[model samples]
Target: MNGRGVITQICIIGAGPAGLLLGHLLRAEGIDCVVLERHTPDYVLGRIRAGVLERVTVDLMERLGLDARLKAEGLVHDGFNLTDGERLIRIDIAGLTGQHVTVYGQTELTRDLMDARHGRGLEVVYEAADVALHDIESDAPFVTYLKDGVQHRVDARIIVGCDGFHGPSRKAIPVSVGKEYEREYPFGWLGILADVPPCNHELIYANHARGFALASQRSETRSRYYIDVPLTERVEDWPDERIWDELAIRLGPQAAAHITRGPSIEKSIAPLRSYVFAPMRHGSLLLCGDAAHIVPPTGAKGLNLAASDVHYAAEALTAFFRRGDNDAIPAYSDRALARVWKAERFSWSLTRLMHRFPEDGPFERAMQVAELDYIASSRAAQTSIAENYVGLPV
Candidate 1:
């Protein structure tokens, strides 16, 4: 609301879940912030994402006053089934770890955050064009962008980049200071979103001779499913009926028998990649969520990881603002990465166990089956898997 543009204590880039949630947390602490998003609110809402909510993620939502809608509409899953071609094994996460995950669509969660933010008369500028960062390593960092054919600038004490992978925030980190490590899977997921009842009440992840297929849901009447395909595959390559037929074959008769196939309202192929950037904080710029790291969708850690990052950033910022002691601010990257690496390991391991790697030999495949079998038979193994699925302490 300042004359120069939107001056505030913090200027967050990208109004996705991470940015929005960070804004809400900061505002709750009486900190001033403005969110800048490149896409329209409707476009942001139109995006589809994983629906799994970790225990910690749910706790964070409760703190943000967003748990009521989630509790009322979200499905609580005690366990889920994992299949390795023939036999299906159920992992009782709730029983093993005393915790469970919530099946709530990221879209709905994001909408809730947006609603809460807007209802409080907070600022979230949509269609922010050509977002650029200036002197982030300096004490006086600022942000500039175009809106309504006019350029705007904001002088901010701290800049938070909650933008996704392709966002400029990470790219602005100066190559010398930012070191990126990435691993791209040779395969991608061809996922479908349909307005039909899910095949099962809980998610079923199956690995068949053909490939990997997952049966998931966003709501009681809406289903989200996915099948593994080559990186070169496109959504056009898999028609609606073809996808259903493939799912039926891959999921096997046990789960597929109840599948209610219908016209897909949305369909796309998502490429999987495990990426992370070192020292998420440099100068006054701090990266959160996808801006710092990315995980494969298999472990459902993407959103959860983002939530953890925002948690650390918000807490550190609060300390700096309240006590004027900024020691914790510099340790943000280390604190966030400790958990980031753990989540990354979990996601990577799960993806390897439940997917048919193109280059996996018989030995590799045997090890995967052996690990799955151990988890199915051993209480210790099950507890380990359950703990990771339910989420580690933030």
Candidate 2:
């Protein structure tokens, strides 16, 4: 509220889960920080995102004592299934890894974090327009943005970019300083959200002869489903009945029989991509979440990866502020990227396994069938998939 500018130890760009989670963690440690977002609170909550919660994500919520609703409402999934149109190959994550994932919507998780902000004394500035990063390579970093037609600057020892891929924070880094890595898929996921019971209690990732389809749910009554479509496909071309009919065909008989078709509340087609930017840190600026990397939604790693990044960034920032451990700040990039790469690999592998590529011939199709067969027959294969699905140790 200072007329000149605001001063804090850390300035977070983006009030998404990644940014807000980092803000909460730092606040718990008695650190002073401010979060800036280009959108309104409602806009942030309206973004439909991945629903699966890895243990790392749930743990962070538990640590903040923000799991009251999450624990009561979140569905604990012991395992999920992978099918090849005919048979269901189950990966018993709880039995194999002694761990499970929670089916909690990213929107609800963000809401939990947002609701706790005022009570916890966390400062988040929404509708922060034209936000930009400045002097990131220097010892002192800061951010500037316009709020309510007033220009303001926030001075901080560190500025974390939770602002996401399209945000100004990542663009602030000179192209010469960062190496970009990306892979764009030939197809996109056409998703539909409806107020209907899911076809299955557990998630089913199906690889049919036609294409890939995933059956997922946010709650007992709310369902989300997706089918891989050519990048050229448009949402307008597929109506509710068309989607449901396609889902019935692709998800196989078991799922189709139980599917309760209803009008879609939300529907969209999102192209898939695997992207990573090297050395997530440059001088005083550190990147977290989508600003650092993006994983295809195949393995449900998008939001979970962001939570892991925030976990690392929070630890590093807390160390620097409390113990004056200079090494943690410089080492944050390596620490976070270690896990990021693994999640990226899993997502990529799953996407490849389930989706039928445009260029893929009979040989490629045969290989996918062979791999699914191997995974179905081998306990070791199931174990590896289970371990990754539940997420690796943070």
Candidate 3:
């Protein structure tokens, strides 16, 4: 101990979006916090996968004056395209919900948050640290970590675990009372970011006899595309030519103009899955972001859900620090789970509608097409999509 004090105001684990954003929020409220991340700054900023930003995410960033970089570099999409080989259906999200999805990568989001934290002179410990939490029952709980080859103990009033799915925070919860819901699809997305312009004005989610293909953009010059492949397929098995050939076939001839095979800046496999853990809090170790739940990328809810988690966690912490009341803290899991489940459902629905199931017969295929047609034609169905896509009223 440096003898500065026996306890810190707050300690946040994982410097991902949730952890970084929570640190920023708490700092804004004059609360001091230390963020410990297992990965280095470079690794965290570059190694993570990309994701879409929902309208609510934009709103929150704007509110925090953190939208400058996002607005400058992000692509704003009005809607998405659902196609079945020859015919295309465009669901205009702006017209339907008065909001649009932003094509900002999760890595960019992490960079922005990291920048904001640094701009405010916040302390974020990157690289492997001996992070361990103890004395949760005490008024002053503590986190012990190593930095610069030296062990340091931080006694904090509260520890907010914003570390993602693989973090240690969730394990700290002894016999969690809530249920776990999860689904792992047989297919995984082979995502590639290339130095090519997008083939379409909006995202194209194609359901084909071969597999699923998604056409999205990162910027005016860079395109992000994905093809559904066997989960067992390795990235090393896919060469540049093979990847483009698959994309060309699934995207149809219109994609030929924009699908130039160039040096890929990024390529990785994203497994399709939906997961949730009830009651996001266990004592002072409150789980947020992927630490508590994860959703398939089909609905573009992963990063948005993380932001939402931080939002609720911040509010709860504010209430606790201000009033000494535990109501918000206890209700944290319930409140977050409501939206988590909604996103889970929406992601599953979207995945089912756009991906061809291996076991589906003709009847199931017809029903899926009919459901798509209904969504495109029915005002009520469109409104439901709009609400969920734009975000559930925050």
| Per-model TM-score on C-alpha atoms | 0.98, 0.99, 0.94
- What tens-digit string does per-residue lDDT give for candidate 2 at 10-111? 999999999999999999999999999999999999999999999999999999999999999999999999999779999999999999999999999999
Q: Tens digits of per-residue lDDT for model 1 on 37-67?
A: 9999999999999799997778888997878
Stretches of candidate 3 off by over 4 Å are 1-6, 176-178
Q: What stretches of model 2 exceed 4 Å from their correct place?
A: 1-3
Name the weakest run of 10 consecutive residues (lDDT summed) in model 3.
1-10
Point out the worst 10-residue segment of candidate 1 by lDDT: 1-10
**Candidate with best TM-score:** 2
Error of 2 at 294 (Å): 0.8
TM-score of 3: 0.94
Model 1 residue-pair collision total: 0
Clashes of each: 0, 0, 2
Tens-digit lDDT track of model 3 for 1-394: 3323335688899998888888888877777888889888888888646557887678778877888989998888888877877667777789988888888878888888888787776688787476778876566788877667767777888898888888887777766455677888989999988888778868888888899999888777888889999988999999878988898888877765566678788889988878887678877778888988988888878889888888888888888887777787878878888888898899899999989988889999998889988977787887787778778864
Instruction: Write down the lDDT of every candidate, Cα atoms only.
Output: 0.91, 0.95, 0.82
Ranking by TM-score: 2, 1, 3
Estimate the Cα RMSD of every predicted model relative to the unseen true structure.
1.5, 1.1, 2.1
- Model 1: runs farther than 4 Å from truth? 1-3
